[model samples]
Target chain A: MLARLRWTEFGRDPGAAIARARLISTLGPLIALLLASIFFSIRTDRFLTTENLSLITQQVAVVGVLAIGQTLIILTAGVDLSCGAVMAFGTIVMTKLAVTHGVNPFLAIALGIGVCLGFGVLNGLLVTVLRLPPFIVTLGTLNIAFALTHITSNEETIANLPDPVVFFGNTFRFAGTTITYGSVLAVALTLITWFVLTKTVGGRHVYATGNNPDAARLAGVRTRRVLLAVYATAGLLYGIAALVLVGRTGVGDPQAGQSANLDSITAVVVGGTSLFGGRGSVLGTLVGTLIVGIFRNGLQLLGVAAIYQFLITGVLVILAVAVDQLSRRRQA
Target chain B: MSAVAARVPVLEARGLVKHYGVVTALDGADFDLYPGEILALIGDNGAGKSTLIKALSGAIVPDRGEIFLNGTPVHFRNPLEARRNGIETVYQDLALAPALDIAENLFLGRELRRRDIIGIVLRVTDRPRMLREARAHIADLKINVGSMKQSVETLSGGQRQGVAVARAAAFASRVVIMDEPTAALGVRESGMVLDLIREVRARGTPVVLISHNMPQVFEIADRLHVMRLGRRVATITPASHSMTEAVALMTGAASSQGPTKG
Candidate 1:
């Protein structure tokens, strides 16, 4: 019924053109992915192999989780500079308790989650109650968290973790394929985040709060609470990702996640999520993460060094932001 | 006043006063809203219409006033409080979120949550029920909307006004107050909204419509409560006075000068 109404209203001329445009946009990324896969398959002997694909998946998993959290925060016109440091803090706290204090690994994991949730609460308090700008507040917290991680590890790496914990990190065999648990966890988080943001009341509240606080408030929506909740939830996810990071490395390093925040934010920006807020999707973020993963993997496969790949990724981020701005302007 | 055992006023205000720093916006204004009636409030710009509406809707707390709902004095801390008590104001801006679709906007503050408690929960919009109810309500008023799911941004001016009226009607239990709802609409759309106002009164919901348009006012209003400065200068029935008389009363040209903004 809706389609028929739209068809009759916007008819064959401009309507048909818009329909074509939407179809192209929906299919555009898939076409690009297929093309990239074909090009790499023809150029490189190892590109299509299970081992190489698995390596790429594991490499992007940590960054993917961070990007998902960043995407949620960014949708509310907010950013989390402390995401990386918070993850690092979680890693140190979990490892110190489990490895140094000989606490149950599961209990230590819970402790790590709790600590990260505390940081999230702090962020929420600073943003909502204190009415501080998210950028400045998170920047301060980022430095503070980074300092705490260093102090927790005593400026040294904590390694030689328990065998069971290490298994979570190193073991990747599933259905006769070499896929790590980190990769699986990343995929699960992405799906869950996507569903919540697109299909639930919690997600709609974020969009409403972002778009117009006054209207949402009039509608009986608790704007301050929703804003705080999103930031706190982001902080909690950083903690979970931190566990995966520590499990895989079999070591906890204070500096490990310091740069992950910047990379994840870049991927979110590139994934079509607006920085000014009120619009974005997890599915778009996945495609965006994939684009980054493929580009980095392809660059390395073609023997391009790390520095060049970093430079290319930086350029891609700028290009993505520019495109987003241009499209927004056109719509306006 | 021939009192035919005046039905209890749905909303009544006495000694209402508001202040912004040293400026006095409202000065002990008295108003009455009875059931099954349309009250037309008219005054010059800055004559306290905005201030009075704001106070009634809980946008501002009057410095001194006693508001009564059905003869019982009450205070609304905010607009939601007033709404929960059956007073819904359709503001000049309409208070509709432009980005949200029609259904979402209709259910904005009061979304219908499903019957569920926990784990892997499934939720779906009760679209059919909401749409059916909404359609039946509008149909009784003889208004037309192409679709309930279209964004308000895509709707024409009359359609938007219809939606706003529908929203106020859908929610309000006793009174629906419109603040210049037809001020920005085209000719035909304004007429449609006027029809809606009549239909609302017929359905027994007292409507407080604020407007300065004389013909539109005389056509729909049952009781014309003209305000000059801060006080109602005349409460003339449309059947008793011509449009010219009502305008004359509104502009303070009548023998009675009405109350000043003391």
Candidate 2:
């Protein structure tokens, strides 16, 4: 009788239904990724080669890493407009310190990372302490970081980077797959971020703060500190992305991260991570980055105009957010 | 009053005064809660019951007052401080993360870590232990939640209230202050909450229940503290007054009866 009435499993949890809905939300993007790949492969012979696939990974790695950081920020219901600018300023500082000033390569990189992290700290302070909107603070920092990059680098590209600076661009051939260490870095960072979000108490706090800051505070969470840590962590990720940028370009270009802010955000949303925050994953972000890369490569192969290519990508991002909102509304 | 009660109360607020510009939320409110007792606080609308609970829970700082935990004067600058001092509150809004599961909600601030060396090196949570313990804990409340993994957002209103009450019951060592725990609950769910309150009191933790529901106030409460305007007017037992007498006291239709001098 006790065995019959046992509540170990009430058949299936009603939550399974909600979980299924979430799975469908993520699967929509995955299917889109697969379809885009198929569409590109059939249209052109050049799109399917292992060499081209490796190149796409290379193109997306920096943005993917940035998106990983942006994913954390967005998970806390904040956006980082200065991400690309942080990377750009980072590249300038790194190259200028190592090449022009002849600082130690490692020290130069550390300084560059420090510079990027500072923007995050500043962003955190403005948002938490000053109670400023994240969008405005990051926008101001984006202009500031961009201007600093220009002024610091004399609006010029620093060339003839050291061999160690472009070390991430070093490639290894595995069968037909040409793998760059930068791609490995992106994957590693994403996995590490995934572990933090899913396994740690602090990770849970991040979700709580984003889900409802007032509730989080009442529940005894230090919300301001959580927000500060998230913004700072994102800054650190941008700094790391700057390293990848240097490796890929093999030169310190102040203009390298110009398009990254929007691109990274697009990747994050496409990955099924919600802009509303407290609902998304780093793994989904990686897929979103891949989708963007595949579309860009395919559109180029189809001889699509740069403007039209731009229009298509922008439309896809908007469409993804629209779908996300619709699904969220239904759930609510 | 028992010997321990006469010595020192579990939780006490002495002459708490709070103001919002021209309006006074709590004006010289004096409150006391003894260990292993359910002290029901009921008042008319805007009678400072919430303001008093807020001061006790560290949700708001009183303009001028002092709170004592086990007779030691405590200054709670924030809710975290109050929690550290063993004061947990279940607000009317049920401060829970909607996306997180039940186990996560139960262990939100003070999550248990793993026991082995891997736990020492890494900050990974003890998920299995948390789930097992949360299951047993919520089971103690006799709530029929489908799964420990279910997000609080997926829960019915009653289940959500159950989670909030369970969280407070599990953590609160000194006192648990609940603000209208059964406000939105149906008849059965509200009954469950009252039972939970009794169970909490049975565990020897003092409970300050703030509710507008008079029958509920009378049913579970060992003693009732009636508030009018901004001051506690009377402290009566279920046997001391009928429901109509309590209503009359609250609306000021009858003269205030001060706490009976023993």
Candidate 3:
């Protein structure tokens, strides 16, 4: 029945060849991004400025790193809802140790990251070993991590961190624009993600596991291990995002990461990565993050209201998913 | 049995038994496949044909039974172990990852890494070599795929089946087992698969075909093993028994001809 359906769909022509069909499905968001950029530039003189572009990069750095982790998990047909909560928790650990306890800055950062890694491992164990649904596992962890953040810090923000905690916030001028090391770190991390997912056998296995896990097992992939490792690494990325958060704000704020989880997902979806998994790229996720960043920066420059900004972002996400679904249906 | 039936069997299973809760999927089933011949395993619903093949393919473990390859006793804990032992199965679903390229699927689990330092340090796949070798293999199989770079999901049914069989034929040093290879295909695509099975035999490896299509089975299989009620009730030659007689034997109408223990 599946073969017959496919055959009839081909006979119908549908006005698109296979190669064009593939290209259009994958590149539709990219073209939209270009059009959005053009429209924004026409409306505002500052939109295409080097300073504004670097500012957009700086604003998106934390989400960019978090989205990399999200992309990996999504590639394996999983999601990480606890990333924002986990990041907030990691920041508390780092700030409390570095300021409240007067611990070494590096050691404090390590402890902060350790807590995030623990959450990641717990998510992985629950999903892979216990065979729990990923959605439920991560949902439960998100709340647990959030509650832990408040209990650990007693709902207090740690301020006045040392210089080392703010190292990533260090800036250098290039081509008449100030660029933070954090943005560079985000780019470097995205490149690493692209290489790992594209070049290595493990990366291919991730795609395979997402595409058809039983087939992957038949082909001898350790799918459980792959999923577990992806979760653990995502936790590590959350930890990194925490430090970037500290660099940007210069204070350990527990209330800060509430929007991060939603934002990172928005970026991932906007970049063309599918929630269905197995057919997206990390670089596309980077583009997604930029799209989110550009839209926010553009809307703010145009003096749009906060409620309208939120509504627009929500609509964009839904539209992107609808486009993806329609394209896939057309292929079928 | 062929003229050289006395020679060592490539793969043999003895008294394989499996129980799924209260259901007995296989009961004291036995099978043997000699080299360079196609053995068709046919049965009605729930007659343990799949169970027996699962034991051989390492998809299922029998409660009691032993398997031997080339007269050496072997125990396969999973499908990977079975693959390493030179046993590959093309399941009824044609277990191929739809999003991956043909070259990637052809070497899915056993990708060839670069020989230089990058392979050791970074572990990059040697794409150039695998693509070239995969193209040659596909051409050798006479599979009319558009490109090795195309994902398997885009190929037609006959082409995809050909790829699956060719994958097994390329890797199976001892035997290839296909479970319902033609069940989902139309008549033309089924013909393509039948030809591929013949090509596999011609390439010097034996095939164990588990299919329900009687005409397709009779056309390719050199021998037939029939099962009923989770047991092997008959092993007959299609040349000797008519299709109706085979169906009657499987449906419990005709008297069981071969050894019950076999």
True contacts kept of each: 0.19, 0.49, 0.43
Error of 3 at B221 (Å): 0.5
- lDDT by residue (B81-110, candidate 1, tens digit) is 899998888877646665455666677767
Q: In terms of DockQ, which candidate is strongest? A: 2
The best-first sequence of candidates by TM-score reads 3, 2, 1
- Candidate 3 lDDT over residue span A64-169, tens digit each: 9999999998888888899999999999999999999999999999999889988999999999999998889999999999999999889999999988887888
Can you list each candidate's DockQ?
0.28, 0.47, 0.45
lDDT (Cα, tens digit) per residue for candidate 1, span A297-332: 887898989899889889878876776665445433
- Choose 1 or 3, whichever is better by TM-score: 3
The alpha-carbon interface RMSD of model 3 comes to 4.9
For residue B32, model 3's alpha carbon misses the true position, in angstroms, by 0.7
For each candidate in turn, the TM-score is 0.85, 0.93, 0.96
> Which ranking of candidates, highest DockQ first?
2, 3, 1
Clashing pairs in 1: A169-A248
Clashes of each: 1, 0, 0
